[model samples]
Target: DQQVKQNSPSLSVQEGRISILNCDYTNSMFDYFLWYKKYPAEGPTFLISISSIKDKNEDGRFTVFLNKSAKHLSLHIVPSQPGDSAVYFCAASLRGGADGLTFGKGTHLIIQP
Candidate 1:
């Protein structure tokens, strides 16, 4: 089973519009959630993170909301921009640190003029 899943391979949105991406997890053991944005071949950069202890976390234009009961989470980007066009990955930190993070395939977000 997919521990973390981003069903959409891509998303397109107009500039200055709201962009929402959805994610679901199958494992109840996952407690810490994080989102990473990547461009091309570069490694993903941390966007925002929320502890299982908290329901939501926001940073400026980016926001992450978690629904623990549903085992789901989402990322919201306000006033999407062309610069925001890139791949976004949802990740979950397992109990062991040696494995790093369990990541979804990714969602390629395209922002238009």
Candidate 2:
């Protein structure tokens, strides 16, 4: 069973357009959600995170929304830029626990200038 999944392996958008990435999870115990962006051959860096108690979180050009009832979450980047072209991975952790995280395969967002 896939604890976390990103159905789309890639996404492309113009430099000044909106870019959206989707992720799904099946584990009911996952309460902490995080999004990581990575460059080629590099480890993923933390971008944004949201707890199960909250529905939305934002930072600069990125926003994450969680729908606990639906077990889905998405990341949105406004005015996508060439710099935003990277792999985004969605991860989840057990609520209020410390056992690392489960990661999605990742979505490669390509920004066209």
Candidate 3:
């Protein structure tokens, strides 16, 4: 069974708008949450990360929020641009990322003009 799941296969957002990507996890052992963005013909690159102790973490136009009680997390991209269009993968790791991450199927984000 997949421990991590992205309910929406894809999302579309207007340029300069905010794009929110949701992810849910069934595993409570997860303590670290990471968001990765991938473009075609390229490997996934780390975007942002949040620890279980913190509810939110922000980096420039990217932000990650974690809800431990609900076992859910979300990535927010403000002012979405064409360059932001990519596949976003939500990953979780145990022991503060000492172990390997469990990645969700990923959600394709399309930024439209």
Candidate 4:
């Protein structure tokens, strides 16, 4: 079974609107959650992250919320701009120095004019 899951394949939002992406996981061992944004040909770059100890983390226009009890997490982008359109991947990893991360399928966000 896939440890991490992104139920929605895509989302459309108007410019200056809010964009929300959802993710779920089955592994409780995961303590660190991260969101990555990727463009057409470039690698995914880290956008935001939250630890299991905290319920939320925010950075500029991006925010990540974690619900450990439900094994769920979400990313929210407020006042989304055209440049914010990209594939967002939710990743989870155990707390360690070099452990690999498990990533969700990714949700493509489309911004309309």
**lDDT accuracy of residue 41 in candidate 3:** 98
Give the 10-residue window scoring lowest on summed lDDT in candidate 2: 93-102
Q: What is the Cα-based lDDT of residue 88 in candidate 1? A: 96
Per-residue lDDT tens digits for candidate 4, residues 1-113, read 78999999999999999999999999999999999999999999999989899999999999999999999999999999999999999999997314799999999999998
Best model per TM-score: 3
The 10 consecutive residues of candidate 4 with the worst lDDT sum are 92-101
Q: Give candidate 4's error at residue 8 in angstroms.
A: 0.4
Model 3 lDDT on a 0 to 1 scale: 0.95
Deviation in Å, model 3, residue 7 alpha carbon:
0.9
TM-scores for all predictions? 0.94, 0.96, 0.98, 0.96
Off by over 4 Å in 1: 95-99
Model 4: residues >4 Å from true position, as ranges?
none
Model 2 residue 34 CA deviation in Å: 0.4
Ranked candidates, highest TM-score first:
3, 4, 2, 1
In the range 1-113, model 2's lDDT, one tens digit per residue, is: 79999999999999999999999999989999999999998989999999999999999999999999999999999979899999999999995536799999999999998
Candidate 3: tens digits of C-alpha lDDT, residues 1-113: 89999999999999999999999999998999999999999999999999999999999999998889999999999989999989999999999998999999999999999
**Which residue ranges in model 2 land beyond 4 Å of their true spot?**
none
Worst 10 residues of 3 by lDDT: 63-72
Residue 65, model 2: lDDT of: 98
